[model samples]
Target: MFFLGCFATATAAAAAAEVAAPVPGYVLDNTEVREIHAASLKRDYQLYVALPDSYRASERRYPVVFVVDAGYAFPVARGIASRLHRHAGMEEAIVVGLSYAKGDEGVYSRRRDYTPSVPRNGGYRSDMPGRPAAFGEADAYGRFIATEVFPHVAAHYRADMRRKIFVGHSYGSLLGLQVLLTRPNTFEHYILGSPSLWFDRGVMFDREKAYAAAHGDMPASVFFGIGSRETLAPGKQRSRAEEDADMVADLRDFHGALAAHRYRGLATTLKVFADEDHASVFPLVLTHGLRAYLKQK
Candidate 1:
């Protein structure tokens, strides 16, 4: 009877241990999610990090590609980085995706964080009846990235600060431009896709003008891409006559300005993808952009 009691107790304990075992769920093989409190923005952010396959086995530091709009762009960036490094002979890189906290659709947050200027009379009046608040907080956002994000990544991972790259699209590209113009050293290379230079009635041109006046040279490599079909059309809600908002023309003009300036240490390339629209060109942009930048030493 004593032996039987001991057996029963051991069997019950084993069952409880089995029940407490954790069930594994599928996850990206080399990715981790970090919840960070951004003191500059006074809010929380989710940073998705994808390390190279050899990161754990090797002590070598790797270049980092920081992707903005990570909620939608992270997977694409991570997959492309892996494929390019594995098959295309490009250098392996650590990809970091900057994401927002839960429940944030990113409409207001992105606008406020990515744009460089707000209209004088407050926010722009949207087609909707109620106007959203004014934005133009790129400076603060840049500070957060430079101070908080960079330090955190460096502390926890093997990041090569000298080879940092910034990738962004649309308004995110505008933010990239702001960082490029204001804090050139923050990123050594920039990949800007379909930059919304139309924001604030061609305000970015003024920014370029100011940068040119203040500095004689820009030491960076930039790849600017746009879709061929991004030209003016009735479906696009803007007419060709309105050149300020004409995306294709604006991109070309911006490229022309950069080329004409011929900043001593700047290397710039512009590519127009055929048959692609604003939303459809990102993957192509990223692939080409990564190849172009990664081909450098």
Candidate 2:
């Protein structure tokens, strides 16, 4: 009886050990990973590049879409791009996923890199991994993308510089706006999804005002979308009228301002996805937003 009990215990332990072991990493088809040293940001970034199916057969240059928050969104973006090209009749493009270094401390780099202005009270909430601190380094992040990332992609791949697109969600969308307003020509098209325009009590509105005052015209194409249910109150919470995070209203105000400004040579579109919340709106944006911005002109 004692010997049988010992054998049973040993077998269970072995099984548990086998179950807990880490599985091998799987590679995505048509995707490659590259690490680039960004001097401006003083860190290394991992880029997940997804090439189009026809890339190897043709000499034609392809449009490139840079997807922020690549750690989570890279595979989704690549899959959407491929599907759209294959069935939806949209133009094929190269998809690039921007990610941070492995085992990064605190994991606050996304919040630091994506926000334009810090909260006045010195703290903010972030969807990324880590508690937020006083962080507003979008300028430095933009510099890294333009100087280091863009150059590297252009040199290695046949990317069309004039047809570049940028896609971002939530805080990532806010970063895209900073790039659009400050460096207008960095990318020809911008797809901003559920931007956190309420951050810092609408600091981005002031940015728009400054841009209008300094420049007579802005030249770019922009597409913005938000969830219809984003304005709804959270579980057992107060209504949007009483909430501070009314994203729907903020997005409407931003879009209104852009339309009112009527900056020369600028094209803009806004869409609200019905029955979708903040977190559920990204895949729709990835599909429809790509088609809206990447349509041949």
Candidate 3:
């Protein structure tokens, strides 16, 4: 009876101490949350900036990789970069994760910021059911990155402005495409993963047509990766709307288009991962892409 009482008392005291103690929150290494405001858009965004381990030790200006859809991609990219740099012999770059509008839900903000144009002739986005009916201002959003984000990074960090890289997936890829088409110089390298090319009635195709008509070359290194299962199954007949949403065909066609143009100094790579769908293939895209593009020569 006496021993039981003492053990219980000790356990109770330990539990009380634990309850009173400060709880430690999770933290990523060398990462900082920075709040930046877009003057033109009148919106504030959070930047998840993760520095390389060598950043503090060296005076070298590192390349900066700007990743979109930061809420999910930031941490994953950070981890991948670290692993790639440590074991895979890839050059370490400063990873910058671009967040959505500070106060708005991500879906709302991405619809407006990541899309190239509004839908045409009642074209519905079946994926984003109940998404805001009207939104597509990527031109303005691109300005925000060029004007606000780039300058800010250049002014603050030891970032090599000439070697900017962009990594984006799905609708995020739409934004990347717009930037690549309209302002190729904004990013020297682009890793576009499973792009949602069916958005807005294939309006991006029109944009590409206009770009080709004006420019002789698109100077950039581009990589496109998609999953095999993103298309319809064997002999599975889908509706016209569903067939139109075939992402696999979309990426392949766009890649072919880019190649057919024979743009001077435009390097492009396309990879399709087997046994993976849209959601399952994103990590592979990043891992394979960063390795292929950023590998130490």
For candidate 3, give the lDDT of residue 207: 84
lDDT of 1 by residue, 5-83 (tens): 9999999999999999999987888999998898877789989999999999999999999999998898899999999
lDDT of 3 by residue, 43-104 (tens): 89988999999999999998898999999999999999999999878899999999988867
TM-score of each: 0.84, 0.86, 0.88
Over 4 Å off in model 1, which ranges?
A: 1-26, 101-103, 120-134, 234-244
Cα deviation of 149, candidate 1, in Å: 0.6
Question: How big is the positional error of residue 221 in model 2, measured in Å on the Cα after superposition?
Answer: 0.5
List, in order, the clash count of every candidate structure: 0, 0, 0
Candidate 2 has which clashing residue pairs, if any?
Answer: none
Could you tell me which 10 consecutive residues in candidate 3 have the lowest summed lDDT?
A: 236-245
Ranking by TM-score: 3, 2, 1
Q: List the residue pairs that clash in candidate 3.
A: none
Candidate 2 local Cα displacement, residue 185, angstroms = 1.1
Model 2 residue runs over 4 Å out of place are: 1-22, 101-107, 124-134, 232-243
